[model samples]
Target: MKKPSLTILGCHSSIPTDKFYPTAQILEMKGDSFLIDCGEGTQVQLRKAKIKFNKIAHIFISHLHGDHFFGLIGLLSTFHLLGREKSVNIYAPKGLKEIIDTHFKWSYTRLKYCIDHIELSSKKLEKIMENEKIEVYTIPLKHRIYTNGFLFKEKPSNRKLNMKEIKKIPDIKIVDYKNLKLGKDFMTKKGKIIPNYQLTFDPPKILSYAFCSDTSYHSPIIEHIKSVDLLYHESTFLKEEKNRAINTGHSTANEAACIAKKAKVKKLLLGHFSNRFPNIKAFEKEAKEIFFNVEASEPLKTYYLDY
Candidate 1:
């Protein structure tokens, strides 16, 4: 099985600089790619990352902040120009559909592919999307506007066949392999029963990831993100700028680390850095003081969630 991975397309806070872009990421799991945020220069970053456009069928927008979703219209337009036939699903806060519709209406351009906009407004945790392989939920966040983070969790996998043990049983047939994988006991034609444990091994460990976008030091999120395998939390400021962080409805590195520690996540990836900091390493250093397993997010860097 392929391990889940996250590719940071951009991690800068508000503006796009020559070296740093805004917030955008791609979470690839189970052969599906989910786009998280569409900040300015997202399309360019995607191209640089060599990710095929068609692979991204779902987009999760945290909020309506310009730095978080300014490039959405351009990306949709590009999909039209590329003649993409696959439908795209966008989960975002209200008003995003209106924004995209207005842009298309004025430009007199219609997309060749379908775009489904699912607006979110719940203040509590809610399941927004689910499939056989994964389940997606919203993490209500405390930001300047109505914003939400996202949680992606891999579902429990089917049991693996123990070929060596199964080969020992003469009565086992190819048709019985499906039942064994589903944790069902095998029954021989002679009425002898075989335990499931003897024929199969436990499934792979389930993995989960949480994306906490721009938000303040909100403890309520701890329960929603507890024990996740990987967490991408926004750390837009350093300790020195704690006052600025609170005023702007953003989090400092220390605050982000506190949440990670409280949630007891396996790893914490910090991003949404402010442009005032020249060296992003300081964010990681500060966060490590509170949470040992912490790293600063880098643009185009891919972090794999594997044990």
Candidate 2:
């Protein structure tokens, strides 16, 4: 399996600091890349990280918060300046289309490429995109506005054919091999039935990654993102700021850990840190106390999801 990797461009909350920007990340899986949230200076971070700007064809925005989508116009303008022709698909909430349209109208900017805006609703869980390579779903989150987290799941590949076992059956033709690999029973020329289980081995386990940003401690999300290989949850506050976290519709490190533990995720990536905290060690320590597999996200760091 080609491992899915996450590269964090920005993970801070509200605004961009000298060190940390807001919530932007690139998830590369099966040779396709997705940009999750385009905060201010995301293009700069992407350039600094040495990632190609055109490689990311899809962008998923969690909410309309400035920290989450302020850089979108700049990125689009840059794409226009670079003379890009490929269409970019943007999956965001309902008002984003109008926002982008207004920005372009006011700035008299015409994009060189097509921008396909797919609006998301926070009412329920829905499958946003599915192809042979990957599947993406929306996870409704509790926030100040209509927000959604995304779940990226890899599609299961065909079962591997057992060559030695197939060789034993001389009547097994190329067509029969295809059937066997598809988990179908094969019939030999001698009229003998070969079970699919005997002709093929199970395929590699499907991998999944969930991105939860700017959400409060909401229990319903646990079900949607259950058993994901890697989970990125916002941990905007420490335990001491629990009240602040609640008031701001954000999660504490401990709360993020609790969600990861309940969802049975293999690993938890904590991000969207508040600027008030200089040291992220406290966040890691607090989450590790509840869930040992938790790690804090660092800007420009790539984390591979190994199942």
Instruction: Please estimate how well model 2 matches the true structure, expressed as its whole-model Cα lDDT.
Output: 0.92
CA lDDT, candidate 1, residue 66: 99
lDDT of each: 0.95, 0.92
**109-139, model 1: which lDDT tens digit per residue?**
9789999999999999999999899999999
User: Any runs in candidate 2 off by more than 4 Å, and if so which?
Assistant: none
Candidate 2 to truth, TM:
0.96
Clashing residue pairs, backbone N/CA/C < 3 A, model 1: none
TM-score (C-alpha) between model 1 and the true structure = 0.98
Error of 2 at 70 (Å): 0.8
Clashing pairs in 2: none
Best by lDDT: 1
